[model samples]
Target: MRIRVGKHGNSLGFVIPASVVRERGLEVGQEYELQLTSSGGLELLPVNQVIWKPDLSIDELLAGLPQEKLVYEDVPEYVPMGKELDW
Candidate 1:
């Protein structure tokens, strides 16, 4: 896809196509880090982008953990001392 640079106020800017925006999950007013590649090509990367999988369940998220490590062998019983709130 080709985009032409035009004047925006006192600066030159280009419009990002809606198709590319939707594909990349880009949001309005989101900041990006502009970089110049070794080959001299321009690259834009999302700033502080988080890689998350919200669809994963708790069990699925912990599937990689060893079974033995999941269980606590022994835990001291809680005893309420003076001035401490007891439930």
Candidate 2:
């Protein structure tokens, strides 16, 4: 886990080993949150969800009224649609 600080263009970074990367099934272009511990240790955490939260007014809600029904398909009694199997 000892990585040397290397120059990366205008920034500096540590080279993560391929064995560690493959074992964790990590990919390129993925972002990880780094935490600095009081004991001088680095911890990497993966970000899963990024949700957009916006403030909406009553006028915005009224304008977003849909003309169509939310569910267009008929529900069958035998099939379990919750499992997400597409017919």
Candidate 3:
């Protein structure tokens, strides 16, 4: 585990042994969450999901940003074409 921290441009980075990386099936560009433990240990864990990021809203989605977007995007199937609902 004990890998030395190296300089990565303006950021600091470290190298994991190929054996460890290969065993874990980790890729070079794969996302990971780094944490500092109270016990003075650093943990690099694979990110299952982005924890720090907020869920994207409809307005935020690029597809929904166009002028042809609607508040209710889902097509209602209750009333069929050429037919009316009986009350």
Candidate 4:
């Protein structure tokens, strides 16, 4: 499909076809990130779907952290703020 870059308030924008938008679950005002590939191709991804570039290997990343981080924090003692319930 062909789309032309048009002017909008002195800025340029192109409209994604309705079929493409509906199929991709895209919505107005949603965020998108455009990636330029090494082979000179463009890739689009939702902000949440993008893999960050500062990729860290699991072994290297985890080696710095302590095992205690896996443990859940102890539950605190509960104090009544008001009159106790009759029940």
Clashing pairs in 1: none
Q: How many backbone clashes are present in model 4?
A: 0
Off by over 4 Å in 3: 49-87
> How high is each candidate's TM-score?
0.52, 0.47, 0.47, 0.53
lDDT of 4 by residue, 1-87 (tens): 888889999888888899999889987788999899999977878999998876778888888777664322333564544553332
Candidate achieving higher lDDT, 1 or 3:
1
Q: Model 4 TM-score?
A: 0.53
Candidate 2 per-residue lDDT, tens place, 1-46, comes to: 6879999999999888999999987778888677776899877766
What are the runs in model 1 whose C-alpha is more than 4 Å off? 49-87
The CA lDDT of each predicted structure is: 0.77, 0.72, 0.71, 0.78
Error of 3 at 32 (Å): 0.6
Model 4 misplaced stretches (Cα beyond 4 Å)? 55-87
lDDT of 1 by residue, 1-87 (tens): 889999999999999899999999988899887777799988778988634447989989888776664323333575556765442
Model 3 agreement with the true structure over 2-68: per-residue lDDT tens digits: 7788999999987789998889888879888887878998777789853564587655776655466
Quick one: ranking by lDDT, best first? 4, 1, 2, 3
Candidate 1 local accuracy as lDDT?
A: 0.77
